[model samples]
Target chain A: MDEKTRRQALKAATLGAAAALASPVAAQMGGSKAQPGGKQDPRSKYPKPPFKSQSQPWPGLASKMNPRPDHGDTSYVGSGRLTGRKALITGGDSGMGRAAAIAFAREGADVAINYLPEEEPDAREVVELIRQAGRKAVALPGDIRTAAFCKDLVAKALAGLGGLDILVCNAARQQSIPSILDVTDEEFDRTMKTNIYAPFWIIRAAVPHLDPGSAIIGTASEQAYNPDGDLYAYAQTKAATMNYVKSLAKQLGPKGIRVNGVAPGPIWTPLQVSGGASQGKLVTFGATAPLGRPGQPAELAGIYVRLAEDDGSYTTGNIYGAGGGQGQP
Target chain B: MRLPLRVLTAGGAALALVAPAFAQGPGSQRTREFVSASAQSDQFEIDEAVTALAQSENPDVRGFATRMIEDHRKTSQALADAVSRSKLAAPPPGIGGDQSMFLSALQSARGSEFDRLYARQQVLAHHAALVTVEVYAASGDDPNLRAVAADTSALIQSHSAMADQLAAKMEEGQARP
Candidate 1:
């Protein structure tokens, strides 16, 4: 499509998403109603596929996404599950990291979030949400693709939050290409640094400060188990993330620290619009899942909470899956 | 690691350890007691560490005192966070009556005497703290405060073990003379 036509199509899709937000189905199926004792049809709880095909520069902002993704700004309620704990979450400006930050704050943790400098706008929203939840919010913006920045990020979080007990290595880099031949050396290196090296550095820096009962959570993906041909580098890094979670759990468990990973299927976030998915794939995102929809970031907030809380004491070295019923587990 | 909130059943040893300081009571009263006691304990630890930093010349004693200040501050902040989350109100953290008495004794000590006293005091303080937190973690009314207790108990246990080591080493050093 031509540039002009593409822009118009983007505008049309945004309007459609806005219209769908107000539809009777969405109005009746309120997101907040899925409380502890409440029940609702899971399949229709959130938006479905045929999403708007949108594009943004690298490291997109969640605020720009059509039908803005929910990071538990309203739906999640905390009962002090993580009260007094301190956490450092990467990519916390959007996606699963944002969801976890909101939940952690509500659960009574002082939170420090790291994101790319471009995501300051989205990070601002998250900082506000955490403060509203009556918890400390520390925003550290830097590129995780560099080892120096990754190390500094952890240090700043430790200093800002005073100490670290929960570390969520949820930030990643994903850019879809038709073939391995199309993947440039720089692109491959960028993916490796962001997905793998960053976590390695951050965890190394953080493990020493984590006392007993500390938790380290890495965000794996469904792509790790079922790799997409185009996402070769990104998929392998997730596999590495899954592998390290098990390995580190064994290494840290004896020291009273728990390590776990979250494998999310097709979750709607800034990733889809910011070159993580091909434009062609964006419209039909999550369409192939059994639920026929993309899981919002809010849907998986509880999984992160469970992994970080003390109640999941015996649940280390495990991968918790949220794949919209596609059976990634 | 943190103990589960509801699943932890206190055994005979745990009850024996807690019996001297705490009396069996209703859940709400127990929670109130835990919160107030925790705040007081944390305050005492911080104040004691500050005094040690000023008085003690031995590297090990000063190092342990520095760690106590940092770790106790975190726990104190956690207690404050729990208090804000619950309906209960906590007084500003201050040393307990017994802690004040202990501090008075430690303040007058000099040189090696100060280090030995600090170690001994740490053993007593952390043992008491361990008992208080373990009891609350085993069965506390508020889920939030129970979590704080569970998390704090792990640190206190570590501190107690360290204190035991320090006290033994200090006594051995004094015996050498």
Candidate 2:
């Protein structure tokens, strides 16, 4: 790690965020055009995917598709909700991870993200966004399949960012199977290790660095409560994740670390396109959501910021449903 | 393996864009000679990935470098074994001109720039190698090299996939906020 380069990147990132957060001196506070006021249908933004099916090999590429999933690259406008905080988000390369990271940096937190070693390109882009927000950004890649890597994931962020205040276990892998009989031992284990095991490993590693005001947010899914027949393994892991949040919250409450989970309904992420869901599933993805469309990643950023903030004091152990009126617990 | 190469593949465009370069595959002599050069390129990437492991703060790139070292070594050995199994003459040492150009440029890069350049090079080199092996696998005069190409093409294609993913993510950072 070049200390000078790291420092420069951080400095550059902070300046970038500062510029985005910078308000025009002449602007009024009541309600500008920047703030949408009247009737607006959130569902009307981006068009849904058509009947076509797509897949990229493992490690999943988000850029190859024709519609290209919207990662909040331009839509998310940040308020200074998490200034100077330090955050480490696993899977921060794309989808929810990327969206949360962009929001965190814009809110003034120095951010570090982790992803699969193969997702470095996406991670680098997130790092650039953080640095653009003028916040320090670092991207780490690793498989959370092992305890050692999970420990190191936190360790690296602590070492790189100088501390850790927010730990978001948002990276997960799901390979949908038609029947329980269709599940291989390895496949079941990978789903468990990535979704359930890794969160435990990461939370355990991140605990020591967290203070009373610190937040640890894990991503659960709408499937936790209302799972489809084909997603037994994934649903089981998510349910476990939700339960784990409650258990950890009970354990960590005395220590001041707020543990929570976010359960997204159908949102357009590489997960669906990358075999987490079937090709048939991708076509109707969020169609069942009450909103009648899949949620965008940008839609989840506010809840993430809220949970990670120092003053988000009232919330803990509870799962926030950012689902488009989908299942909730 | 430099800027434009990385740029081309960042969006999963590597296979489509570089497919043409290997459409005819290299000539028979070049196909026979490719193993030595490909092995050298692996060494080149290993050397570069090692540098990333040591210097990159980004875990993603560091982890990728580790994979590069591990996977390339295994494939290199596989190729060497394939060569030994057949009557093909031993390839000369040290790498070809284009690979050297890539390595020299990689040697000079640092920080995120280094990560970017490294991933780009990996994407280019792997795709080219895939094309080379594929060309030979599909049409080589040497039965042995063709078998080796057939054996190695899958791994090379996978490497290209991994590199393509890496390049894709790195491109996200390039977008002006």
The candidates' DockQ values read 0.01, 0.01
**What are the per-residue Cα lDDT tens digits for candidate 1 across A1-329?**
77566445533442333343344433443464323457666766777544665789988888888777877666666666786899999999999999999888877799999998899999998898787766789999988888788788888999999999999999999987646777899999999999999999999988889999999999999888977666788989999999999999999999999999999988989987887876535654664465556788988999999999999999999999998766466
Number of colliding residue pairs in each model: 0, 22
* CAPRI classification of candidate 2: incorrect
What's the CA error at residue B123 for candidate 2, in Å?
51
lDDT of 2 by residue, A1-329 (tens): 47566545544544444445445421221111233236455665554433356777666866564455666554455656787799999889888989899888877798988888788777777887777776789878888899999998889999999999999999888876756877899999998899988988988888887877899999999789877666888888999989988998999889988999999987787787787765545654554454545787777887899999977887899999977665776
Taken in order, the candidates have interface RMSDs of 31.0, 22.6
Alpha-carbon TM-score of each model against the true structure: 0.60, 0.59
Which pairs in model 1 have colliding backbones? none
True contacts kept of each: 0.00, 0.00
